[model samples]
Target: MIVSTNDGQFDQLIDDLSRLPTYTIGRATTNSIVVANGKISGQHARLIQCTPTCFIFEDLSSKNGSFVNEVRIARKVVDKQDTLRLADTTFDIDTLLALLKAEPVKAEKPVPPVSITPKLLSEVESNSLNFTEEFADLKQVYEQYPKLRKDCRNREKMIRTGSVILSSIVSISAVVSTGGAALPLLHVLSGAGLSVLIPTLCSTLLSTEEKLEVIDKEYRERYRCPNPACRDPFGTREWELLAQQKTCRRCQAIWVQ
Candidate 1:
């Protein structure tokens, strides 16, 4: 469906199709799209049909990956009629077609489909993408550790309060016995139940131990080696100092945290 071509011109040519189920832009002659432009790879990228009205633009991991507006994405879900860019090309999906063109692809080795999750709150919009990660060391030093400690205290307080109420019941039932064959037995049973229950409740109601949390926010934003290739965590926090200036233990990235 060679709707348009604008490999090089004053500006890009526009393809106004409503949606496209599947298509690719590549320099390879076998590719559905034959982009002869030198800027694009021989086998660049393609759009996979996820549903009748949904699609995923997948980068084939070329020298330069395809861009949704300007952001580079390995894979991302998109709704019908969305447009994207690869090198100098811009494409509009064609959803109005009754049946999309299908072909059986054979290869030396199979390429796995890229996993892309669509945003439910809003339709996929191009221009930019934001990702979040985590660092537990930063969380423990600055934020969550205080809250976790407070929770431990609250749980201990609840156990103490519950123990006092149960103790009162046990003391009354053990000493103040009503006289009768059933009454004495009932008192004994009540005392015995409390003896087992109070300890059980205190021990198992909630864990009093601190749990280790994992790193999760944007990993690069945390105190770590600034080198994009390194994963070494920045070491040795100065307890008396409040400033963020620090050095990476592995890559020696001397920068403010």
Candidate 2:
């Protein structure tokens, strides 16, 4: 069964309720019909399968309570025509059920059984060993940090040297060498100042330190997780917690750093 509502809150509310025999409508993450509101209880109301195709909704001693078609119901068998309300959102139960009935059911394709040979087993073992080696590379990723800093320093020095040399040449040509001819002193000084300003702007803006920092950040993100089996991205709440602990959410493997 598929259900869709115009409300942003119930965007992913559509699912096969038949497969989920008992659907709990609440703010809790564990609930099937998750309301995701502060007002609703953790395990608010329960929806039970009465028959093969029939469902019944029952209020589970909720603080806010549940209603059907504006009337507060303690327990009521769901009908296609019924309008259910929980918390702030007013669900059009009749329209949702109609859409569910109209929606076609897709049959799942059967997966073929794996027949592991000696060559395949050898490949699998090789992959497992390579995976561990890849994670070992994460530890050595920071070893390149010293080299990166040195390179950035060298590049900055080169830029500074180049800028100084260019500006010096321009200044000597325009100011020191008078060409033994009648030329305006203001024009010559202005030309030297303009030449120095261009090089100074280029050196300041195209900084090697900024470029090196960007590259370092990219690598840090790439090699965050030490365990290759649990190489989940390191930004989420679960991964953040894992940083303090020795457990990973992806592989459910306990590790020591």
Candidate 3:
């Protein structure tokens, strides 16, 4: 289960909710999930385990009320995929369960601080520089390269959409602020300045070609054989083709399923 805290951050992770037959969610200390938000009543809601894969959400007549997919409900049968809201905080049950099933992260030891001179920094940089364009496992490339491509596409789309919205807002605001009224010279100058700034900001935003160039650079940096010792660039090679090949040309790393 996932719980949103009082600070409006949904960082709390409950690995499993099935452990308990019934779990209470409220602002009170005795509840299973004690959310300290004012919207939540002292005894807000409870989840009663009905079956292995099903649970019943019972709202305790909260002031702000409980919701299942935005509809306020007193009692409802909920599955993992249901969207649950207790007062103001909302959480996806499927997302929470998915997070629980995801691979656990290993704890890392803290690294000690290092005091470095220019010579030491130079030596460190030289030692850390990887000449080979390969990883130790082809699986890494198979998994990560597609995600990189998707991220690039998403970023490009976001930038384009944002640029349009930003330019439109600036243009509209500049027009609306004037309101056809005879403004002071300073106000007119300010409006003119905003007009000048609109194009400048729009021009600064990366074009599709520039975004593609960045993507290409990123692709060159990362789309290599999954062998740290011999990272050969798989230039313009389709992932399917690489998978069919089964092994890296440079590193001989097996691309096992």
Backbone atom clashes (below 3 Å) for every candidate:
13, 0, 7
Q: Write the per-residue lDDT of candidate 1 for residues 1-257, one digit (tens) a residue.
A: 11112222101100111122356657877776676678889878876542233445778887867777567777665544456667766655553132233475566786897556676334433311211112223433334223323433343543453344334334323332222112232233222212111221222212333111111111112444434556555444432232343444454443333
Provide the lowest-lDDT 10-residue window in model 1. Answer: 9-18
What stretches of model 2 exceed 4 Å from their correct place?
A: 1-20, 51-53, 93-257
Reference-based lDDT, each prediction: 0.41, 0.46, 0.50
Predicted structure with the largest lDDT when compared to the true one: 3
- Please identify which of the two predictions, 2 or 3, would achieve the higher lDDT against the true structure: 3
CA shift of 31, model 3, Å: 0.4
> What TM-score does prediction 3 earn?
0.30
Query: Each prediction's TM-score against the native?
Result: 0.28, 0.29, 0.30
Total residue pair clashes for candidate 3:
7
The candidate with the higher TM-score, 2 or 3, is 3
lDDT of 2 by residue, 120-187 (tens): 99998655423333443433334433434454455444344334433443432322222321112213
What does each candidate score in C-alpha RMSD?
29.0, 27.0, 25.5
